[model samples]
Target: MAEAYPWQEALWQQLAGRTQHAHAYLLHGPQGIGKRALAERLMALLLCQRPKGLEACGECKSCLLLAAGSHPDNYVLEPEDTDKPIKVDQVRDLVSFIVQTAQLGGRKVVLIEPVEAMNINAANALLKSLEEPSGDTVLLLVSHQPSRLLPTIKSRCLQQACPLPGFEQSLAWLGKALPDSDEQERLELLTLAAGSPLAAVSLQAQGVREQRALVVDGVKKLLKQQSSPSQLAEAWSAVPLLLLFDWFCDWSNLVLRYQLTQDEEGLGLADMRKVVQYLAQKSSQGKVLEIQDWILVQRQKVLAKANLNRVLLLESLLVSWAMLTAQR
Candidate 1:
């Protein structure tokens, strides 16, 4: 394995050692969490002519070519465009690579990123290769959700489960890298990022905290009697509602904990959580889940249609909470 993230040590060992079977590997994980990094690492392990003490021998011919992105044997399958799915044509092209000769004349490492992005036809097309893979062909499929993959596809490869790191583990890793940083603030960022160290680091890089704060503060004021959807929409038009949804889910859990334990730290919700719950009780038998379910559905729509007017959609939908609270 190439030098990898700390969490990947055990996974890399299993794939590298000949003590186990050498079949296609499913390196499943969400965006970030170093899925791409791990895929590249596995590619090095398979294609490297020699390995130095469990790490890739970078000086070898295969490693050199692979490093420079000119390796002919290793194929990476991806969607035609960022928003597009892997089409039948692309998957067909992939099958051609698998059966044909390797440019490196050795192991062929094929990596399909977010394999779930493959359309139905493309997924079915890949099935034949998965079922009868040629010798020395290594498959690496990375995904955030395995369930999104076809059952046939899932059955054809070995699954390497990659989960988000724990908050403390992520925090400690960020600490060394983010030395001289504010501890409390960083931990808060780490916690908000779902314990993915990369996420925390990237969030810091992009000033996600300030963005989130702007999102929360913008929505908070809309949770009141006689709140106008138009007014709320106008205020939050520039904010991304999907990002708001992400924060709300986290905030809702905090509220749920507050409701149960009355913990003050959790009690200080950024205001949208209360709005969502307020709407939920009004429409869902005092259950916040109904509101949450609607939000989830809207999220899918938002992802599917990038042109959605987030402010209008969210303001109209979330205004229910204000009405519910006013009724109370």
Candidate 2:
């Protein structure tokens, strides 16, 4: 069974309670939320031979097949590799699958996650399936970034928006998810995850707090001229490039915000509060804006999975960051 999130109770009721299901549903929301899980749960409910009050009966043959990953009528479409675009060929295969009769004489279900991963050709191919529904087939499309999807693709499906759980609700869930972690630690994790509880759990597993501490210390040393950009870059080799870019982008935003508003409360993350304030005081707004723009471009490239020299990228970022305080 897909893990049911407490935040999604109303959403589940709304979706599962529908008298007639849509041919296609586009579930759009921020990453790390339970959009995918909700779709999975819906798929199971649709496929179950005997549903028990808007829920799948785990004892049914259909449920057993699905749990065993041998369900013939259900298909999942995703990128072959992580962060890679779904190829047109894969969409072609899915189209072929769509035209076939269900082996179980039941509904056919298709789940495509991160639907924005489909490129132009692939997305076009998928449009055919969406335009023409076959039998009792249901298509569930999941997208973390719906803005990147083609307008036509968005128009054909019933769009469902999954919102982030409330801070208190997420924190409450996190307490049970991570009983070993204290309240303060969970609070910090939730903050760092931008209020996404699942993301907070993932960050905890990845030791993001430890990595953040190291990066924070490195930045302090860099500002003090105690550590060079190249040395710090090498030291941070173990850290993920995307994560590093995210932190730097966040810091740049915080610095600019502080410079404009002079809001002590806006200096994000306690570990970097002093550093951000100091930089905001010393650094010119123009320089901060310049770095922020550069970070956004680089962050895009990272998201696109461009072939980038990690060390060089980090060095360049640090060099630009260090120059923010040079005018002082």
Candidate 3:
């Protein structure tokens, strides 16, 4: 498969050793943590008729077909807009590919990315194919959140979690790609990114820096218990819900680091240690985990246009969050 992220190399070799011969697998992890890259690489290695296990022999006929995206035995299922979910038709089409005999007379490989997008009907349809994958056919499903997938779908595959590389590793990797990047800025984004290199890069480009300042300042005012909770929520009404989650995680980790290691440098400086620690220690029980679970529920409700009142939603978040912080 693709060159794995640093944290994933060991897992790749493990899979190479124990799972290369399996018929199905689920490579699941946080978004943008390189699961797709690893999946493609694994596919290449498996389809290679003469793999050294060191690497796929890239010049082989199978490799050539894969490179051209014309491999008869290799297929990738995804949720295109026209196909909001991976359809039964898509699953049925696989029968032909699995039965038509491989173009190279080799193994058949199919990958489904974000397998969670498969709606109930589509999921059940794919379940049919999973029931009886043909000889030497390999199925790989890539899901960032397997919780979004049906447990039945997960049961058919051998699941492996792709670990995210921590901040230090992400910084070093992103450094090579951003030679002129500001050290403080890079670390801030790196911490914010939670081990995803692309997320680090995307944050820099997305003006998340200023956005975070707004969020941090807003959260601090709410914690100070100065501004009316409703007013604070009104100000933050437009911030992405994910921003709240990201802030919570990063702030908690930062405060934990300060308490456990006393590393108040760079991004640590961006943190108001006492403020962070207070908020972190508080909402943790009241809202940290609960809000996280709620966010997913809210995301669906909001996205579905299920009568979400932005005012009440944001106000509830701030009020609960502030009340908890007050206990600290």
Candidate 4:
């Protein structure tokens, strides 16, 4: 296996070379922070017939098969379709695969990415396998939102936490990765990604920066009474609802912070400092908190598969935000 990220080295060291390995490991971390990469590296090391220290020997047959994506004992379970939940049948299949003997007479490894995507029934189905191991079996479950997982599921495995890198470290790594990007652009991307270096790089590559700017600008206009909620929603039709809601949630927190402290220090969103300050001054502390609460509730609804009218939801949030400064 190739080396994990620079920040992940210490954690990797702790996980490697244990006398007795757990039947399952839950690797929990924020999205785009290399949790999956770390899990993959560990998986390769576990399946390698001849591992050197914590890494796989690339010359081995097991390594070659894994690299070629044809390893007989390796199983990966994920949602069949994008944005869909993993079904119970999928977990059943994984359970069956786990009971089988390894083709190479070695350990069998099962990888489940974003385990939160598994619905309740699916999670319940996998619980038995997790509780009782059949053979030399290992399960690596990667989750970005571990809170959504069943507590019983979490308790059945040893958990490993992966944290975001420090700001300077993230910026430095991002600088080397995208040499052509200027410091300001890199910082902007980092801010947009909530300080996750890999997420920043991904957002930049996906042109989220441009879309984010449009949303922020539209928000500024809405707050200034220059744009209506419906108009802004229509203008931002291309932007995903979840992304917009998340951005609003972030901004709402900042507005509340400014209202409480009256200081802008350490408040991210460098490019929108002026707008954030303007909204902070004009908006009341209570109103900001109310809107923040509303955002949280709506975000949970969106995640819980609640049926919602997109345009109406967006308009409601925007209108509430625009009225934060209204005189009682």
Best by TM-score: 2
Q: Give the candidates in order of lDDT, highest first.
A: 2, 4, 3, 1
lDDT of each: 0.72, 0.94, 0.73, 0.88
Q: Write down the RMSD of all candidates, one decimal each.
A: 3.2, 1.2, 4.7, 1.4
Query: Which digits, one per residue and each the tens of the lDDT, describe model 1 over residues 153-235?
Result: 98889887875666677778888878867888777677666677887887787777777776566556665334466776676
Candidates arranged by TM-score, highest first: 2, 4, 1, 3
Task: Give the residue spans of candidate 4 off by over 4 A.
Answer: 1-3
> How does candidate 2 fare on TM-score?
0.97
Candidate maximizing lDDT: 2
* Segments of candidate 3 deviating more than 4 angstroms: 17-20, 49-53, 81-96, 221-239, 248-269, 272-274, 277-312, 319-328
lDDT for each residue of candidate 4 in 1-328, tens digit (9 for 90 to 100)? 5547899888888887776789999999888788888888988988999998777888799999999999999999988987788999999999999999999999999999889999899999999999986899999999989999999999999998897888999999998989999999999888878888998988888789889889988988897789999999899988877788889898888877887788879466776788778778887888888899999999988876678898999999999988987983
List where candidate 1 sits over 4 angstroms from the true fold.
1-3, 225-227, 234-238, 260-287, 303-309
Global CA lDDT of candidate 2, please? 0.94
Among residues 3 or more apart in sequence or in different chains, the pairs in candidate 3 whose N, CA or C atoms overlap within 3 Å are 1-41, 1-42, 2-41
